[model samples]
Target: MPIPTSNGHASRVQIQEPRTRSPLPPSSSPIAFKEQQGRPPPAAQQTIAGKLSRNLFKGILFSQLTLISLLVIVLTIRGLILASSHHFHPKKWYPPLLASVAVSGVASLAWQCIFIYNPPRAVKATFWLTPILTCSVGILLVLIGSAVDAGIGAVFVLFAITQSLYGCWITPRLEYTDKILSLSTAFPPARTREVVSLSILVSVVYSGFLVTGIGGATSTRTNLDLLFVSVILISLAWTMQVLKNVQQVAISRARYVNFAHGEDMDAWGAFRVTVKHLIGSICIGSTLVPIIVLIRGSIRSVNLMSGSSDEVMYSGADCFSTIANKLITYGNRCGFVHVGTYDKGFVEASSDTWKKLRSTVGLEKLIDSDLTSSLCFLSAVSVGAVSSLTAGIWVLLIHKDYALEVTLYAFIIGYFVGRVALAWIQACVLAYYVAYSEDPQSMRFDGTIPNRIQRLQLLSARRDNRELEVGRDRDDTDNC
Candidate 1:
């Protein structure tokens, strides 16, 4: 009985000892191990996604390149076959056109290579859609042109072809900018809508003025018609300049933020900056006035010399307008470069751009190459070709009566629409070049610079070497 009682006391003592003295593993150690194991799947998923995106980009690029190559081959073969049958004439215009085509093809291939080698995350659907829409509209215009009048249709076809080529060339550049900058926010639909609305308004007003001035001039042959024409020209120029400035500001800010490695900028900020600089931009834009006046005067003098014949006058006027527009465009480009580089007032920016151009060797060429005028020409050609072909097919199918009017309207509509879409890309590309020119290092992604950019930087460095050497020599001479 006494042994049994002692056993109960011993059992209690054993239970209390185990409860108090059993050692626990370090607190939350197992939980932390599980957490560490859980973390890697997310990282692994991210890695997989990145690789997939890159692969998809490369695939799209390759497919596009293949298609373009096939198109070029087909075109060349068609031209050759036509020439053999005496259907194709090697006129003065033919050689230049062929040369342009060849150059554009080469430029396109080069551009594709650059993109593939440095593949961005994704190409926006809009980039592809813009050109397609542009071409479609152009084609529609061409069909309309044929129905109305052969001459009008021909003009519409020409315009459509030019627009198509521009779309092809510019779309890629825009895609590159989007990818390079990691601009998740696609082209602002609202901004595009606004531009379209404004452009339409201006175009309508300009068209009215044109009609009125032409009729008045033809009927009255007075100074009043000329005055109306001048008003139309000035107003149209002013509106275009304003729109251009707005686009530049928006794109440049996006580029600037990207270059500085800052957080993404919103549309409102871009719009505000544009509005803030509106007056100054308008003033800077007006610098084109003197040049325009000189062009118009020269055109008038030539017309007078030609005895004011209608056909001769029209041709001369068209030629002069083209020349003047080109000059204005180049000037505007310089201004845009300055704006992108320094984000300064427009006048200051213009001066700065001029100074940079004057001071730097090969800088102009570099800018032109980076911007790729040949590519632009090619793009315009592509757009035009597609449009013309489409329109021709439609004309063949339906044989509509109002084809000429349709062609004219379509040409105008498509050109403006495509222009608006591409303008954003153009502005972004301009800003990209400016930023690169100023500081090539700032465009690094993941601490790595693109090979093309590196090559550019190397070239720029070589160009500047003489200047650096001269400075060094002068310093040594002073020391001596």
Candidate 2:
């Protein structure tokens, strides 16, 4: 038993060691090993507290869409009620409305800069705030028109117009390439980038419309021509936006289809096809519709100039501007819903009174297309019809009496109904696109992103929490 000392015996007997083991390949390095574990390395996970602080600052106001919507609704409702019951003068309404537009538009523009300039992690909050502030401003402007002066409100309308164009440009730029390629029906980024660039380049050209409208209004002292110019500007702005929208949507669908089929190569190919189609569509569809509208408007403009029942022409012009403002305000607020040719008549007819000229012209017959293009066609017609009808309503309900009471009641009843219907259509269309675009396999992805709205809020919350902890630690350190 004493002699059975195993460790001592083994040490004495086993003198030779086995050959040393070879190190792993570079691909199997320790850094890679940790990455395989599904977590970022410690250095990667670490971030500065300033990031959270910046996010908290940016997102404090913009995170809650519900709150923003409620605020807008409340303010709009209050203004409408006061205007209706008190019969406030046009001067009073114009000032407040202009103030709201200037303030909100400026705020939104500022926030957009924040999103671009904020610390990396803080961007979510900055981006979130932009739309809410912008929307608040826009809603105020629209409501203001009903309260006091639709003519003056036309100038402020450019804010929403510019914002939409900016969104289409920036969102596509920031978003994933795959998403852009998938959604686009044309040159995808190339065309989008061009549109954005061209808009910036031609800001002067576009601004000419505003200047002309304002100048014409001043020189002629005619509300009708002013309204006509505003209406035309709005129509052109929307047409530009929608042309880009169609390209985006087409590419999106094509990319989604390819991805869904598990054919990554095919998906890219499909995206290319989509891009081409989008270009053709924009050339064919977008340009064509607006041109027709412009031609008709031009003819009408000529007739009015030639002394065709100046009252009726001006009345129609006012009608055009009012309805255009309503549609632009509401349409921009709502998601992009293009009610094609068929829906135009429905929307036009929905108004309390009918336009004999609009009805007799039968524009639908000339521009009507199938259901796939239904949204585009409808969008053109619906925008025209809606703008015309709302203008008529404003003249009938408010301008004639110099009070907003009847207009407010009509807006409350009509606007909400229009909103609900529009919202339903938007929700359905968006849902369909989103659902259809998703791949069942992609759904299983560990890192699949959530909705844009949700993602921004979560990022903001996380950033805020981090900042609070850092602040607390800093305070404790100072105290000690």
Candidate 3:
């Protein structure tokens, strides 16, 4: 066999014993790059081979996201007390609310215990119960909201009803979604509370925004309070999205290293790399989703306030906007996978992810993807509904005045728990898609989900074939 000469030359040279070994190239040598990367020096005393960590953990620095998150936290807190002072009743609201949160926390902890043991069945159960939770919550809230004249309750009821309807719609086609979620359980990340801690922080940030923004809203124009409220809300919106993407990116990086390179990267290490290098990429990557949402919401608000003179025009706008938002959301899910795995910017990652999905999995995988997202979302809210029921009833019987506070706190705690549990599944599943896209052969971690996309593709093709045959038969009958 040819051997790498101790000298930095291509020509073959005789292997020598350790005592007779030649020196390696100095850092300043012309052949340093080639020599460092080339075949190892002859069997002499060579330094131990480098670890994967040396190469795998690297990226250009981007810290803007870190700054933004800090800024939002400060602003949201300031806005919270200044804007919502009137709504907060310390004497009537404090004790019951604290008790409600404690009860909800215990319930939330119990719920998470199920997830810790058998994840799939827990998720499956949650998925099935989403419709029930939504419908019940929607009906009860609508009745109580009407009785108590609570606009916020009505808003939640509307959202709950919509979710209930979607849960019903997605029920029949849930097999693949179940499989998709089940498949993601194959990856068991190390115990890392970074994501959970951030989720709680985010929940707190959201509470501040919800209270302060609602309190600050006014019919009057050109007011500093309203402007400050708008800015806080917007910042909160963007900050949450960016932080979510950050978690996904961190999870992807860890899973990608585990899958693609066979490295054992823990969540903390991956998150550190994310904070050190990929934070800015995540911020830029996640910006468009919030922007699209803001635009759609603004248009809807304008149309509603103006009494919707051109209903058809506004309807068309809604249709297009919804389509665009859904498309971008899907694209972001896939695209962020690329960003996490490769040293690419958001747009390039998105373009590449789309092309890879088209060439390999096609449109059918998107169906399964949609199913997974919908089910996860339903499962999340359903958890919140159950938590609210657990805590709110007890508080309601005694401190009837603080029903809203109890429900809100309980639901938020439960939702935060759900987010902590489910976000990893979503992030890992996307990483799986990206892994399959990058290299299909190495996905032996799970056999069932590897062929799932292919199965979907075949089913799609067969359905199309049947449709074509039916069309041809109809044409023949018409001719006869």
Candidate 4:
């Protein structure tokens, strides 16, 4: 061979070939590697098992991400709306708004602790127990208030409404459970989402009405007292509707499960049955009371303002002053009622005017009384009871009339008693079924729970290992 020359000056010169990198191994190439292994192309002849696993993983990842994203978007929207409405400003609505937020947070935590979803049996137990307990307290308070006076009943209703709403907001956020799950055949996820959306809209409207109506209600046949009563009525009616929905949900869940178990239960059939019960119970019981209160209060307010009664002061300034004094005096008396007999004196003195008119129609007694009379006493008793237990609470407390104070006291005591009774009933019902029940699905968990758990764990581990192996293969091919 002739020597290579740098300057090509020699008679003969050899040129070295330029270096070029070797192509990748057949194992690394998309088509060639597959052919080398005597296997079909992955896209065309992918193993069914591998494809299924990949699809499942992708689905799980997508679902998890979607849920997280949805939650974030909802929260962001709510925050933006609140901010734009100036409700987020600390100077304006912060006190009540913050209070509501704090209450809602705590309520949510409580619901998660008590009613978080687990197995079917646990879910049923929780659902049955919660409604009976909550509704019983509410009903008992109503019954007691009827006997004593509205003042007593009104206090319980207010507490029940607030607590219920707080629980409602919290359940979906934390535990993804709904107390109203018993109300409709709509899926809990979908139903709760709708309910929350609707509730937010309703709340905003209600708040706007409240803010605007406050001044108008204070004079000219419109007083905060009457406006507040209207609000309470609206709230009560809304609550009843929610309760009806809750019943429908329960029936739907039951029918769905039944159908899944090869039974003949259908959604429409269950819905009809649910509607009958809901209309009979919640519609009649919850909605009626508030509606009647609203009507009576409206009539009373219209007549009082239009008439030349001793209470009427037609001058704008005089009317404003009178309204203000009435409010202040009412608030003050409500606080004072529980401490001494001052509230009782005022209530007795106004028995002909604001006192409850007891009359028996057929088998039931219709006790007609104004919500104002009821609220004053209820507020005073609650305030006083709290004040008595705590020192500085006295400063924040108000007193109302004697009958109202006693009525409120009775309502609170009745609620406590009702809770206990409801709990006992649920326990009894659960114990009865657990002891004497023979369910077909029992075979599903016939083996020791630990054995099933172990199987699940093994499946998970195998899946994880397959993923790891696939990842490792890609990394090796890249390095090569």
Highest lDDT scorer: 3
TM-score of 2: 0.28
Per-residue alpha-carbon lDDT of candidate 2 for residues 30-59, written as tens digits (9 for 90 to 100):
332222113211121213452343244224
lDDT (CA) per prediction = 0.41, 0.31, 0.52, 0.30
TM-score for each model: 0.41, 0.28, 0.63, 0.25
- Between candidates 1 and 2, the one scoring higher on TM-score is 1
- Show model 1 residue runs off by greater than 4 Å: 1-148, 155-238, 261-264, 286-334, 337-347, 354-363, 371-406, 443-450, 453-480
Question: Rank by TM-score, descending?
Answer: 3, 1, 2, 4
Q: Which stretches of candidate 3 lie over 4 Å from their true place?
A: 1-88, 93-112, 143-175, 193-234, 290-331, 361-370, 386-417, 443-446, 469-480
| Candidate 3: 10-residue stretch with minimal lDDT | 9-18
How does residue 94 of candidate 4 score in lDDT? 23
Better of 2 and 3 by lDDT: 3
Q: How much does candidate 1 score in TM-score?
A: 0.41
Better of 2 and 3 by TM-score: 3
Ranking the candidates on lDDT from highest down gives: 3, 1, 2, 4
Candidate with better TM-score, 3 vs 4? 3
Model 4 CA lDDT for position 422: 20
1-480 per-residue lDDT for model 3 (tens digits)? 111112221111111111222232231122321222232112223233311221222221123334444544554455445434445443344444344444433444455455445555665676656656655554444444446525656666677666666656756556655555444434344534555455544555454434333332321123764564455445544554556677777677555545444444566655655665555557666665446545655765655665443788677666765665555544456677666555455555666666766666454355334555554556567667776665556555655655664566556645544554455567777766665555554523444455555766787799999988988998999999
When 1 and 3 are scored with lDDT, the better candidate is 3
Residue lDDT tens for model 1, 1-480: 000112211221211122222222232122222221121111112244534443454354346435533433444454444554543333321222222223322332333233223223213333343345445544554445444454454554465466556546655355334343332122221243343344334443333333232222323224754564354444434444455456655555544444333334443445455554333443354444345446645765665576443796778767765775455444545465444333444445555555544344444544543433333323333333333333334433454442332233223322322233234445555554444444443422222224444556677789799878987998999999
Shift of residue 188 alpha carbon in model 2, Å: 9.9
